[model samples]
Target: MSNMLSNGISGLNAAQVALSTVSNNIANAGTTGYSRQSVQQVESIAPSNGKYTIGSGVDVVGVQRAYSQYLTGALWSSNSSLQAATTASGLTTTLNSLLSNSGNLQSSLDTFYGGFSSVASSPGSSAARQALLGNASSLATVYNTLGQQLSQQRTQVNSQIGDAVASINTVSQQIATLNGQITVASINGTPNDLLDQRDTLVQQLTGLTGASAVTEGNGSISIYTSAGQTLVSGTQSYALSTKSNPYDPTTTDVVDSAGNDITSQLSGGSLGALINYRDTTLVAAQNQLGQSAVALADSVNQQQAQGLDLNGKQGQAIFSVGSPGVLPSSSNSSGGATVAASVTDVSQLTSSDYVLRYTGAGTGTNGWSLATTGGQSVSLTANADGSLSGAGLTFNTSGTAQVGDSYEIQPTRDAASTLAVSLTDPNGVAAAAALTATATKTNTGTGVAGAVSVTDANNANLLAGAKITFGAGNSYSITDGKGNTTSGTYAAGQPISADGWSLSLSGTPASGDSFSVAANTNGLNDSTNALALAGLADVGILNGGKTSIVQSYANLTTQIGTAGSQANADLTTQTSLYNQALGNQQSLSGVNLNEEAANLVKFQQAYQASAQVISTAQSIFSSLITAIQA
Candidate 1:
């Protein structure tokens, strides 16, 4: 009877606890990050008899939290991928829309180039020249607008990066706090709710920036970034902070708690996406656009310099571009060095930034090394005048450089931002060639001289002009506008050269036949230079002179479009994968109300049955006591 009573009491206790666990599961069924709980049972043993052992009623050992480390890890990985793709996709789309507008660069460029043709039709028309100038101004405005937008995007991205780092730090601190609580709770029993909270925080951390969670022996978790930086370990978490880049303050870099740079190491979440896009894609597009602006302005300015304007003076630059940007490392010694870069060959220029680092005096390679930001080495040539020239730029240093001093030279990154029409007056438009050549009407044998083209606007004898008189053996004598005479041999279809101009003579020229080269004094009727300027629309002027201005813009548009399209596709795939992983994770840990309801019935019945047994034992005890007393 005593053993029966003991068994009944043990069974009732186990059943009550089981019922409580089922009720708890039902109550928290809709809770986020909640895992279903169940009772773990073990048989309570009785002392063995001489001949046989007896069994005891059930004992509730613990409440087990249904969780799987493998499933949860998969979910975190996929979630990180999805977030990164989403961020990149959104930015790429914005860039594509910005550059793909038909009315942006393409339309403005066409209008500007076409204006030259209108001026070529009526060289002396003031209204036509004014319209051409307006077109030029509009072109410059378009370049300025695009450059500003790109720069603004970079600034926006930097701001976002700062926000992400802040978020990661906040979440990390919370997880660390949870870790300390969980480590203590695990000593008594499974800290189910606390573990759920920590895992939730870890997932959020991963979304902002990728992280991996490792379960420690004491029910705590250690978190690491995808780049292997320690984010959280046991009860402690390291904080991340943003700092200005060493060379470019407009750019932001991430640093670890120890003041180490980790900007390049974070490459897995939304934070990584913003940094990568700003540094690589956005800046490259900006540089390419600036390259186009530089090429257009420099080409036009060079041509304008070689011709004569309406006032019969040499043409000045019609466009002005911003100079290259130079930034020295912050760690350099005070007044260490300063570098100014100038574009020397437009065709040889690339859309890349260069880093010029001084390796110390007496070092090989002229004490300095040059490389692109992408890590490709660039060959630098030392000119006789002590200037360094490479990749279409000439770098002149004014101050002494320290051994580790470095300069970031962005050759064309800001050119578009400062592009402007330098020639503001309509009368300043260069409309005529600097000189002209004409054959005398007395020439025989079908000999004729083509139009003369200016070779050097600064030539002292350019306006002096010349007369070429054919002599024996196809030789020619030149009497220049200055009354200076010189002689040279000429062949059919070969040029008769002057001090600043040249003209081709075709067919036979009898001896004593003369052709004259003189300044285009009657400039109003000549449209030679304007026609040449319009022809620039078709001339290859970029990428080693194999791509025209229009084609260069097209390539930039195409690159952005392709990147945007690919980003969207990657985002779609990542979303799908993340969904699948999340489903797998939830299936194992998520609470089911229907299942808990059934458990409620089962445990309730068991409790009642165990109570009946206790009641029976009590009745038997009462009757036995009554019989003994009678």
Candidate 2:
């Protein structure tokens, strides 16, 4: 009977233990990192014929908690990716805005080029020239502004990197402290909440540098970089420093005790992305801008030299080829090397033939003269190959020309045509007519019989609106509004007229001089100039309208747009993968409220049964005592 009672008590105790396990699970249902626990029961040892044997009554063997190592590892890995993606996406979005189509850089370029185009269409208009200067100034202002912004972003990233490095150090220190606590708890068989805290710290570290954590046997974790560099081991923690690279000061890279560069080894996380953008992406974009600027300046200057202005000056360079920071100065000695304008075709030259005259007399002359004793003249011929060639010329050569000694090429023609000019005197004479005139006749075959004639009926209107045509077989005609024609075989360096406008062909006319009919007579007030300036289309900037400043600006916009789109796509894909990983981890480790509630009921019933068993034993013992007394 005693054995039976004892057996009953054991059964009750077993139920009570199970109830306690269930209750503990329910109580910790809302706790983070708390795995649900369950009681495991086994049969107790029994005695039979003085030998021990398995008992029928149940006993609590062990308490089992739900945990999966694989799930935990997946969670940590995903957390690293998630942190990195978020950081990279946020930074790229801001950078994209700074370099986008709506950015100030592109706008400034448009305004600057538009101003030049405006000047080209209305060469005689001072208002247009002033507008051109204003646009140039604005463009410079915008470039400086954008450059400063880029500098500021660089500084901001540097500061952020420093902060992140500090955060990483702090996290490493905290993890080391937690590591010691975890090791002590594990040794004492105590609860490992501190270990869980260490895990949380590791997750935070991952966000900063994409570090990974490995839990050791003693419950301490070993933290390492994604590339396997030890960050923390046992109770020791290594510090990280943010320093400028020796080779590239603009870039910030991580360093350890040995001062080895670790930037390339770093992958993922906010710090990695910041460094990557600063060193690679942002730097590359800036280099692209530099290339575009050089190409733009070169192309525009080439085209500008080809076109003729109101002053009858063939296209002089509109932009300097040197660094943008430098300004045009009168001191030729200090100007470094002057980039000579390249002429691709003789048609690019204006009809004006210029003679380089000695501008300085002896050592004290203030006025220019054609004396060769002071300085020799240079004769420039506009060749059909878009190049200017002159004989007996020395630039920057001492004793050849002094400061303030003028070398001027005065184009003789007011006519709009592609022509070549050759200098007669290889050693240019001052203020001398450098080109000789020749005449050819088709109708009379006489020396001066078919000479080109001029009719300046509206000579003032000549500069205003005039057209000259060179026909086949060396025949040319100048026609006025009244259908009057001056027909002759056009001679090189000869003067002709139409509608009172005096036109001089001072150079060898090329096939490119064919006149195109003027569509309208709005003159300086024409909207065509404005439209061309606005980059609506190419307007005679390049041969066959092949290239324009507007096109360069568009290309820059496209490049930035493409880079931004790629960055966004990468961010999105990484985020999705990270979320999926997190979901998988949650399935294995996360708490279920319904399961906890069910456990609560089970534990409550077991506790009640244990109490009833004790009560029944007490009643039986009391009844036995009463019977003995009776």
Candidate 3:
């Protein structure tokens, strides 16, 4: 009877523990990181005679959680991916909106060229010149505004990066604190609630930095970045930090607690998206915009220089652009050369950055080389003036350079931000050609003269006013103002070029028929340069003559739009993946309230039955005692 009572008591204890566990699971079912737990039951050891043994009911061995390490890890990984895609998509959408907005670069460019056409129609009209100036100012303002907004976006990203680092530190410290608690508690048995808290913190860290968790034997898990840098180990947590780049102060470096740079190794989280967007997409867009600004300004300025303004003076620069940005490496020696860069060929300029490194002291086939960030090197060619030229840039060195010295060259990155209309006065607009062509009065040929055009603006500098004499059998001769003459073969439709001026003869010309091209002295109302300016809208003057300015800007908008679309698609896919992973984890570890309610009734019935067994045992013992006394 005593043994039976003891067995009943043990059963009652086990059932009560199980009921408590079920109630706890039900209470925490809706909690964000809580896992449902249940008591593990073990049969108690039985006392036995040699031939027969009796059962001893049951004992509670431990409380075990419904946890799958694989599922939890998959969830964390998916969460990181989803967050990165989301961050990138939001930013790209903003960029696309700005690019596609009304009154943007494309609109401004159209207005600018329209103003040029207006001036072409009325070259000597002050109203037309003033309108052109206004349009030019509007164009410059557009570039400036876009540049400022991009800078603002970069500032926002920088602030967010700082916030992410702070979040990482806070979460890592919490995880380390929980690690200590778990390590101590798990010496007896793993504490279910503490494990939940720790895992939640680890997941938060992963969202920020894409960190991974490694379970240790003592129920504490170690945290690391995807690159294997320890974030939290045992009871000690390492922190993440940011440092200002010495060469470019506006840029920052992400580092670990030991000051090891890990910026490139960061991926698959919001931090990774921020860094990638800032470095690649943002920088590329800025450079492309600047490239367009530089090319447009330089080409127009050069053409303007080839023409004469209304005042009969040479045309001045119509726009001002910032020079190439040169940043010497912080590690360069003190005696390294002072390098300056200038654009040599606008057609060859790229929106990419290059590094110029001085390998050693040599001339023709030797010293310096230019390379992209990917490490593909280009050989440098030296000009007669001892300067080096390559990739549309001329590098002039004022002093000797060390062997390992390097300079970062950003050819057009600052152009948009610093672009402005330099020609403020309406009278400063150059709307006339510097030279004109006319058929000689005494010419007896069937040849008719078309308008003399400046085919090569730079080549026009060689002009000293020349006369062309047509000969039979497709031939022509030129006589300069100095009376020196040269001869060349010509076709009726082919251009006759001499002293930088070019003109084509239409129809057949008899031998000895003459034409002349001379400096324009009566160009007060001339519209040749204005016409040329208007023609810029259709000319392939950018991207090595592969795209016009308008086309280039349109292409930029298209690129931004495409990138935005891709990012949106990726965000959708990643979000679905994360949701699926979360659901799978929940299915394995989540608590069901209905299940807990049924457990409550079963445990209550067992408790009652065990209590009745004790009551019966007491009744039997009391009766025996009474009978013995009688």
Candidate 1, 1-630: lDDT as tens digits:
777777888888888888888888888888877888888999987788889977777788899988888998898889888999999999999998767552488888889889878888999999999999999998998899888888888889999999999999999999999999988888899888898898888888888997888988877789998778899998899999999999899999999988999888788789989888988899999999999999999889877766778888878888999999998889998988888899988989989999998998777467888999878999989899989889999989878888998999998888888999899888888888877778899887578778787766668888887788888788889998778899888766777777878787678888889988887887787888888998888899888999888888989999998889999999999999998998898788877788888888887888888888889999999999999999
Q: Give the runs in model 3 whose Cα sits over 4 Å from its true position.
A: 363-366, 444-450, 455-464, 468-499, 506-514
Rank order (by TM-score, best first): 1, 3, 2
Give candidate 1 misplaced runs (Cα > 4 Å).
1-9, 50-54, 100-103, 361-365, 441-447, 457-461, 469-471, 475-500, 508-513, 626-630
Q: Candidate 3 at 141: error in angstroms?
A: 1.2
| 1-630 per-residue lDDT for model 3 (tens digits) | 888888889888988898889889988988999998988999888868889998878889999999999999999899899889999999998887666553488888999989988988988899988989899999998898887777778778888888888898899999999999988888898699999998788778778878788988777788888778998898999999998754566777689988888888888788989888888888888888898998889888877866778887667888999999888988899977898999878888888888888888664334788987557676677899988888788998878788888888889877888999999888778888877788878877778877666656565344478888877776778888888799998765788877666787688777888888887776678888888888888888777788888888888888888888999999999999999999999998999888889998998899889888888888998999999999
TM-score of each candidate structure, all chains considered together: 0.93, 0.61, 0.92
TM-score of 3: 0.92
Residue 508, model 2: Cα distance from true site in angstroms: 11
Candidate number with the higher TM-score (2 or 3): 3
- Pairs with steric clashes in candidate 3: none
The global C-alpha lDDT for each of the candidates, from Candidate 1 onward, is 0.87, 0.53, 0.84
Give the number of the best model, judged by TM-score.
1
Residue 157 error, candidate 1, Å: 0.8
- Over the full model, what C-alpha lDDT does candidate 2 score relative to the true structure? 0.53
